[model samples]
Target: MAETDFDLGVVTAPSGVLVLGMASWIDHWSQLGQPLSERASAVASIGGGHVQDWMCELVAVPAADDKALMVRAGTTTSPFDGGPTIAVLEIDLGLPWAGTAGNEPIILGDLPVDRCGMVLGDAVALDSWTGDSHPSTDGLADVTYWGGYAEAAHLQYGGELIPQHGSHVRGWLDLPPDDAEKIVDALKAWEGDQQGRGVMVAVDEHTDFHRFNRASWTHPLRIGAIEVAGCPVLGINWDNGDHSMRHRGERRFGQVYPVTLQPSPEGQTMMRWTIPPHAPVCDGPD
Candidate 1:
């Protein structure tokens, strides 16, 4: 990886600086059947919580030919709290390879192998922060309870709380398993393609949906090619927990149908689908 320049955003919440990476890498370690406490211990040994100069450095572990487990400076909202986005040292696990072709494998410079513990630590911290409780180690359990839910609700509700009086029904388009898999694979391939741009799932305008009391229209949901260990589905905004919903009165539900991936005029990869009638519904307080 020829030292590609990355924009390191300013550090806002230093204490809250976190470590996170692709779901593929996390699944790799978890599949090894390591105990959660042991995983957390390994991470702590590698400087998981320690910070320096507004950045945390760790050794890169190779995942494949073009990819390595490296730390890149970035920022994201703290899973512990929704507000005040914090700095993050993202682990690049090399899946859906972010680099272009014919480049040397991205490698961390002059770092001792012993420092690889930091990578493990970051991964453990991420699991803890998300409160997945996969291994449920002491001090790691319930570190943050469903922060994404609140964030998702806020994104859809347009407020900190879901309105007290309204009918809320989330709409989802049922895609055949094979079609969903193909779409996810295509999105990942596009992410790796040199000409590929950001992709999204464009909710069919003809579909009826609502969030709360309002009509609650939404922008296209961005597609993240990476898998989220928490939710392994291929649905729209699966990782972010932002699914489409509609007002009950506007509901013109349809049946499960296949979808095809198409490119928008804006050069973005997209898929359009009608909402299925059988959706999870939540009625607001009376």
Candidate 2:
């Protein structure tokens, strides 16, 4: 396949710097958001409802530490039902295939169910950063958290902290305060696992419908702090393996519906950190 070139942007941190100098647009979420819908409607017009899911054209990027081990991902939604999900990750890690021949692409990182949760944000404010418990064993790549409901309220996950009333809806528990270091430390652990073993997508094999991925050992764990189109996000990663869960036979990773993930025309901005769930003791794929 021929490749076209484009410079997405650049990111710099104390760990190191990353460059998005990739020269091609693989089948991705943005394409899924707009192009897929147009195609689906076109197919339906001709009385054809079948559309192939988009394929994840594998590309590797260097981590902030320049290790090429840690992966940053993007987001997308199911075609028919618009749900919140990481569509595709535009990793800035240098392009290097995992296999010896450099042909096999790297997989997504699986955050142990006990240690991660989903996070979403725009340029300034994060839409969801619920107070889940992900106790960090040792300091590492982690996000920050608070010890009060006021701060936890910023997070819109896990707990059922009633909106604005500062109370729970019966069974749901109140948000708890936590140490800020836990955020980065837990991230470090998840990234460490990726380094020790190999990167693996943490999503589950749900083949029926697009659902809010559950947290557990069998399902994919969510973790990681990444920027997509200038928005800060944290969630589960996927691979060709997710096709079965998506239940799309048109082809793996080719289907799309409609989603709007536009970056602020003003530019990228940082958002608050969140305490996702913790990884479980049980183990499966690394």
Candidate 3:
């Protein structure tokens, strides 16, 4: 099995840069493709993380000798630096730590264990291929699910079929057909007019966050659960058949109206992102 037990001492030498084991090599996520020795130089360009840099390397024991196993071997005698003294980094690189295959299925090997790409094994993390992810990082919102698939009442825990997702929700996004223009127009209108508030929509938060500590090792990233049938039914994004019951309120089938936003003339900020009568998509149990 992959190991993730690193003993590196994490500290920020200066600024807000997080450092570990006295390593000048800032482990920035962008530097995930760089060599261990040169990674530190990339820190200035990439951002910092828990141990300061968000990206680092993990190597197996070279000689299997007591010193080598403990990373006591130096660069001259082993494939590591700082001899055994620096070898303690294995604690952070492997096993149940931030850069091992522990989080991802360990069947595939060769690549680093990380969430941005590999999880201990070589296979890519859950949604890295999805275009919705962060461009370079592939991470989704810290907590979300299908963007706006659940009715306002179902956003909290124990509302409806939230149990199907097991626990918490995040990562899925069901955008309107005209996602671009609508968002822009709404923003513009929100800036132009001041008026009474429209409506409020809230989705219960059932979150189960996984600490990013494995392959595809960039930062704290999660694949979060997906709710296939238990989402809310929005006329703008779904059909009448997709709903669990007859949704015959304000928003009818095939309507493409966006949630409007406008500032109140009475000195109040009004914001909303939904159509009316947005009911449960899968109103029934899973």
lDDT of 2 by residue, 1-286 (tens): 1122222233332222222110121113234564322433343234222233343221111223333222333344433333333443333333222222433222221111111222222211121112222222122221222332323223432222232112222112111224333322342243323235311212112211111122111222233344433333333423323333442332123332221111122322111111121122467678
**TM-score per model over all chains:** 0.20, 0.22, 0.20
Best candidate (score: TM-score): 2
lDDT of every model, 2 decimals: 0.26, 0.26, 0.22
* Candidate order, lDDT descending: 2, 1, 3
Judged by whole-model lDDT over C-alpha atoms, candidate 3 comes out at 0.22
Alpha-carbon deviation at 195 in model 1, angstroms: 32
Clashing pairs in 1: 1-104, 1-105, 1-106, 43-121, 209-245, 209-246, 209-247, 210-245, 210-246, 210-247
- Give the range where candidate 1 is weakest over 10 consecutive residues by summed lDDT: 205-214
Instruction: Give the better candidate number (2 or 3) by TM-score.
Output: 2
Local accuracy of candidate 1 as per-residue lDDT tens digits, 111-213: 1111111123223233332212233222211001112233443343222222211222222233344544444444333331255542332222111111100
lDDT of 2: 0.26
